[model samples]
Target: MASAVSENPFGRSITTEDIVDTLGFFDSWEDRYKYIIDLGKELPAMPDELKTEDRLIRGCQSQVWLEPSEQDGYFEFQADSDAFIVKGLLGVILSAYNHKRAGEILDFDIDSYFDELDLMRHLSPTRGNGLRAMVQRIREIAGE
Candidate 1:
């Protein structure tokens, strides 16, 4: 999966650098939605076993599943949801922290990232809260 990211320059790898790069490209929420959905398409499928009750994200209006595994020094994630926009939001998040160390993920300025992308203001209240819940869940997993 990492190799796939390396192969496509336009398909930004799940990294902070890529997120910064992506926010620079899209000019509006509509364009950003297209970009985010494209990111979701790039996500590797979540394993069926990892999609169980324990991995479910709470506070989400839609069913969301997220699983994290640490390999070497980084955390690898697998996530999915029944809702399309939520899936896309998960993709946006994975782009920022997937395959990165817990400390790094914790250190990221998520609010700044959202502000730069102009994301939360445009999202519905429920979706915005879901996004916060997702981040909080990941932070708890990181023990940060």
Candidate 2:
């Protein structure tokens, strides 16, 4: 398995509360978008070696790769995307799911979080579906 480092920070230093509060600070959607993109920049670099066909998430308009590592009960995920906004979306999702236990991942009310972020209202239909797809994929992994 590939080791995780700066490639992910969610559920560690970057909590869901942090994301929510930071997003709430912005008055304009434009600024919020920039913040989301900046979060994407924090993803570090995902190795090309790990971006395999099997790791590619299905139903995304853009190509997204997700890989998970779990030990005992804790879980962490490393994900990457071709689109900048999609990468940001991954960061938002990871903020909830990554580095959490299976139960925590499964129990997180992602819809409420997104609602709090006012995310779905600003997203395109395809982007909304893609976001749901990413969440679904992670949820399946945690279920296993």
Candidate 3:
């Protein structure tokens, strides 16, 4: 069984609230995008072995790998994307859903959360679709 780092790369702990607050601090969308990419940079590396086709997420314009594990009844996910911005998006998704129980994850209003972040409107159609696909994949895993 593989385990992931509890903390993101920056040493400081990251949480969904923290991302929301930080994103709110930036006035321009350009700045926000940069911030998101920075967050992506902070995501820990996924082992090459874990990047198999079975772990590849479909619908993304870039290649994405997701591997999930349950620990003590909570789910933890490890993900990586070939594109910088996509990786950042993965970081955002992980912040919202990681270390949560299946019921909790199911209960989460992801659309509302994305609305609060003002995220979806800015994304390209393909990216938006891919995002939904990733969420759906995670939900399916949790359901199982």
Candidate 4:
């Protein structure tokens, strides 16, 4: 049988640099938020069949699912969220982590990236926690 991971053929072409540059162009947080939501809108829809229980992210306030696979030492993740902002947050995280080599993903300074985006301060405590949870999970997967 073909692996479930093969079913997604997932790709996240956006980069963290693109997000920082775009977010910088916005003069206000509201505009930045709109851009973020738009980014979420661009994410290819994760099919409902892939949104299985084992894929669900545990710490998020909204329902989030992630399907991960490794091919030739690079990781590809297909993820979805029930909330718009959460989806946007997933976009940010995926932009950094998806399709990256395990070493690359593990080496990335995610906190610094978040600081450059000025992200965590703008988020609610719960949301911030969820974002961290997502990162931690991805990092864990990479470490394995």
Top-scoring candidate (lDDT):
2
| Candidate 3: C-alpha lDDT | 0.85
Clashing pairs in 2: none
Q: For residues 1-144, what per-residue lDDT tens digits would candidate 4 score against the true structure?
A: 101111123443778888888999999999999988888888879999999999988899999999888887779888899999999888888888877778788888999999999999999999999999999989999999
Evaluate model 3: give its TM-score. 0.90
- Structure candidate 1, residue pairs in collision: none
Cα lDDT, all candidates: 0.77, 0.86, 0.85, 0.85
Taking the tens digit of each residue's C-alpha lDDT, what string does model 2 give over 1-144? 111222323434476788888998989999999999988889868999999999999999999999999866778889999999999989899888777778788888899889889899999999999999999999999999
List pairs with backbone clashes in candidate 4. none
Q: For candidate 4, what is the lDDT? A: 0.85
Q: Residue 87 in model 1: shift from native, Å?
A: 1.0
Best by TM-score: 2
lDDT of 1 by residue, 61-126 (tens): 998999887777677678998877788889888776676667777877888888877789989999
Candidate 3 lDDT by residue in tens digits, 1-144:
112334332333466777888999999999999999998899889999999999999998899999998877778888999999999998888877787778777877888879989999999999999999899999999889
Candidate 2 structure lDDT: 0.86
TM-score of each: 0.84, 0.90, 0.90, 0.90
Q: Per-residue lDDT for 78 in model 4? A: 83
List CA RMSD, all candidates: 5.0, 5.4, 5.3, 6.3
Model 4 bad stretches (over 4 Å): 1-12
Instruction: Give the residue spans of candidate 2 off by over 4 A.
Output: 1-11
